[model samples]
Target: MQPQSADGASRDPTKVRRNLTYDQCYYHPAPLTRVHGQDVRTRSVRRQARIARREAALPSSRTAVSTPASSGFLGSTSYLSVFRETPRLSKAPDRSLCDEFEQWRTKLEYAAARVVRLASAIPFYLEQIRWYYDKGRFTVIPAPIVLDSLSQTVAHMESHPWNVTGNWASIYSDLMAATKSPLEISPNTSARQFNSLFTGPHLRFEFIGFIFAMAGLSVQGRFPGRQSLELGNGEKMDTDAFTTEMVLACHHCIEVCKQNSHVNDLTIWMRYMHILLATEVLGEPSERVYSLFGDLTSDIYAMGLHHQPSDHVPFFLAETRKRMLAVSHRTDKNLSTAMGRPPRLPHRYCDEALPLDLPDESLFEEKDSLERFLQRLDDGGWNRDGKFYPATLMRMRHILSNLREQVLELSLGRSTHPNYTKDILATYKFSQTIFNRIPSRYMYTSSCWKEMDAIECLARMIVRLEHLFSVLQLQRIRCQENSEATSDLLDTCLEVLSIVVDLTGQYNIHEIKKQFAWIYLLKPRSEVIRTLSFLVSWVRNTVTEAQPSVMVGACLELNNVIFKLLDDALNYRPPLGSGQEDARLRSVDTGQSFEISIQGTRGDLPSDVFNIGLASGESLSWLDDLDFMQTSSGLSLM
Candidate 1:
């Protein structure tokens, strides 16, 4: 019998078998003579015989084979035999390969679960650490261990293809992307090319990773158990246990890269973030914080980031470098003012252009486009095209930097120049212009981002207050020589104090408590307290009235606000001492007399107020009760 072709034509059974054998030999290409003993029949016949034998040796259950096309001989056993023989043509799966794949899947699941668990606990850890910080029992733990554990887990997850699903999955993805390194290139590559490809990405990744981790920890702290709460497990985490874990984790993060000797921009940025968190949120001593700041400044100069970025550098990278310097400059200026230290990054060292007032997305799209846009707006002022919060901050920071210098000169009695007052007025006017030009969107009252509104408002308020303080300081210097300037100085000081009280009253105790967890509030809070205390002492000494009037009412309002705001764990007290009393009443003649006292009960006054300036060596200081001033290492501006 002959097999029928697809066209329904009959063919010779012998010829069909011969063609099938030849086709199998061409496709499979196995030595058929070795499998089957030598026979006098042709090669095709022998090959067909060998295939038939192999199929027959298999069990009945495995006889059927699947094919993509059909060339049938109806009810013919010979055709079925050829199809079954084709099944043996391909290689079989090895048991070892299956086991290896199973092992990999299992490890991948384990790694993913571990990473998720650790990342999930980050918030709880932050809360615990904050508790310790508030209690002044903060202890440093090794950060490398925790980072190493997380790193290994991430590596494990990277080895397999597994779906990561959750709210934090995006953050995890960002972290992974930020930390990813490029493939290693051959050593024979040119040094310049190698530097361009490897150096920037590696450093950018480290800085970005550090930022992501810190941000993750911050988010966890800010929104505790929100993720688990959404899971509907109804499982509540213990506050104490989680807080302890967070404290340990934070210590680890802050100290992880401390031992690295190769200081770079990434390391400098990491330290900058860490220092801000430690000093501001954790309330670490200013001396320790400033010491780290000193180290960071050294790194900045070493990398030449303090200078204007060259055209050879990528625009995005150059801008980033400039932003880093700007931040460093701001940090140094603010801390120097706060701690009464000479700024490490002086005006001479800071020749870099300010960061452009462009949105991150626009700059990210094409660096060259941004460069061209920036060149067009070369007046070195705020770009009014968009509402950029960071640019506004940098602008305010620049004004504050100038204010710091002005205040410094005035404090040190070095403001004897003829145009000193004129310069101060010009700077003040510039700050006011910038403040007015700020888009309403960035204002706390007008911003759509309510969550960040309070912080934004606080920053703006601080900058304004600093500007006012600078003017008041300058006027006080002028008043020393010309008593005619006394009334203007007093008015400016009152305005500064009034703004602090007004802003403090806007937020309830709960809102203020929440703001305390953030670093931005630290300096502003300290400044407010110090300024209020100064005003209180000034008013009591200078303003003498038979009855409590407008100035007296303002003084009382400020006292109430400060007492309420600082009543928490901070325990801030007004500076009260005979030295301060002497300084305030020193110019008064023997014929002059005035009564001075707080209007509240004994409980309203800080116990330290009575003790402050009581020592013979003590003298009246401006905002001297600030934490930095308490340190013996503080630089003497006076």
Candidate 2:
């Protein structure tokens, strides 16, 4: 019988057993004691005493090596020397520590930047609230309170050295909870209590906070650069850094809401609002935007906001629900129209009553006051005031939603539903009536248009543009067979383009070019693109000498405006490159030379005239060839 060596090679078993001490055989105590047994209990006791004495006699340096089964032995290691070796565990590398420290430092810098950026913009936001209030814009009461809180927060950040990080869930939750109008009555609350709540400051400061935060984020995302002038007293602000911090802060706020298992209406609305800004204003084509939009619609349905508010519902809350619903509907409609997809929110599902055409001040009044106002409105006592802008806009949006549905139906070849054409024409006429109902004071007439405030003018233009768009869309369907209808549609499209061009001229180009700066302007600009594309295609296909000159002129004007608007909408900044003649440049130069030659030859015709003639001729020639092919195919079939 052989004993095993250190590397597991066979050795003399008897000799190995003889050499093994009681301490080394601790795991096999029963076997060793049995071999030396006189009385089993006494032998075991003796073996244990000997093992204890051997352990105590070991040097302090060897204690770690000699200690067996600290974690409880799974198997005997008496023959293995590997168990005696102590391996020192090294600390983490300096590079790893440095990297972590660097990350923390960067985060701190970003936080500081965000605080400064938010603080600097606080004054501007406060002034905006004041201005909106002064102008009778529908602002919540807690706007001032939220503004104060923001001011204090900014001051605290400035006064201290802090690294603000994490989800900020508590702050977000607190702010959102504050925005709920306390005047809101459940089915259980008394009417008297509700009335008292309504009269008190029930302005949702959470909403205000959300808007400010989102606005800060938007501003930061749009303008990432250094200001030429110093901020405050010689503070050279790094706007780009500030913007980065703001983006992170906004993301944190959103993430906090998202991480919650249950999202309330306020959070849902805030999230939806952010998505709108991201998609429409920021022009971010993220898939998350669409996903968030889906979630928003689901939330709206869950809250039952698609249905009309019951009489028991508070006026402020009802109005808020209606506005949120309207915004959701409009967002869905616009996105569907743009993407050529069916709208997520169907018009039939949203049968909520149109928002009241009353001032914000009227909303907080007693139930009786609102009931009486509704009675008057029902009896054809609607007032035409600038304050009605929001209600009017909502109504117009509803109409546009219907228009969009009709357009979708037509495009999908589902227009065979009876009286489709009549319904469309009726809608067009109704839209016009709505536009005409806007107070003459708010209307933009050439003589007194300049007298109107920019905001009011923008509102008027939006209404007019929407009406024109509806008319154009209606006429477009009929234009396939009726040249007269085609001509009418073309005119409507031109009017749309003209209105857009006029609106663009009214605003400072710099302001218009700013990211998400003028959301109202996007709708008209989009309409212009749509209308121009249709008109250009029509003009190319059809040859009409009577209005060729007029059509060509409109096309030229629209082309120029479209290009400019596109540049602005895309925030296009030209790259710094060498002025080299590429193929595209050479082609453009050749085209110009040809145009000059034609202008010289045709003294009566303008360059545009020649260009239009050539383009239309080519299109007409292509159409003729197509017709000839159809006729030849028909003959062959016969």
TM-score of each: 0.45, 0.50
Instruction: Give one digit per residue, the lDDT tens place, for model 2 in 1-638.
Output: 22347787543221244565323422211122133326667655644432232113211111123322122211111112122232232111111112222322454333223333333344454444345445533232323333444444445435642221222223323434544423345643443443333122222332333544445444443444443213332223343333323333444445444544454545554666556544532232234455557777877776677874556665565665676676677778665544445668988877846666655545555768877656545332344434444555665565556666655555444567687777666655664566454445545443323566555556566666655654655565555434445446545654664454354344453433352244443333345446556655665555244553423333344344444444343352323572442332343323221112111111222212111221233322323222222222112110
In terms of lDDT, the best-performing candidate is 2
CA shift of 108, model 1, Å = 29
**Model 2 CA RMSD to the hidden true structure, in angstroms:** 25.1
| Cα error of candidate 2 at position 419, Å | 7.7
Task: Please give the distance, in angstroms, between residue 203's alpha carbon in candidate 2 and its true position after superposition.
Answer: 15
Model 1, range 1-638, lDDT digits (tens) per residue? 22566786544232243455322323111222122334546544533432232112211111134121222221111122222333454322111112222222344332222243344433343343344333321112113222333343334444532332232343334444533443333424332342343222232233432433354344344443323222111123332222222222333433434434444545555666566554532233234455667877887777777774456554444555666777777677666655544667886657846676654334444447756666644364566453434555765566456556655554543457787777656655653564454444443331222345455556665666666655655565555456565556545654654443334334343444455434322233345456656765665675455555433343344444444444431542434666875554332212122222322222222223222331122222332333321111121112
lDDT computed for candidate 1: 0.43
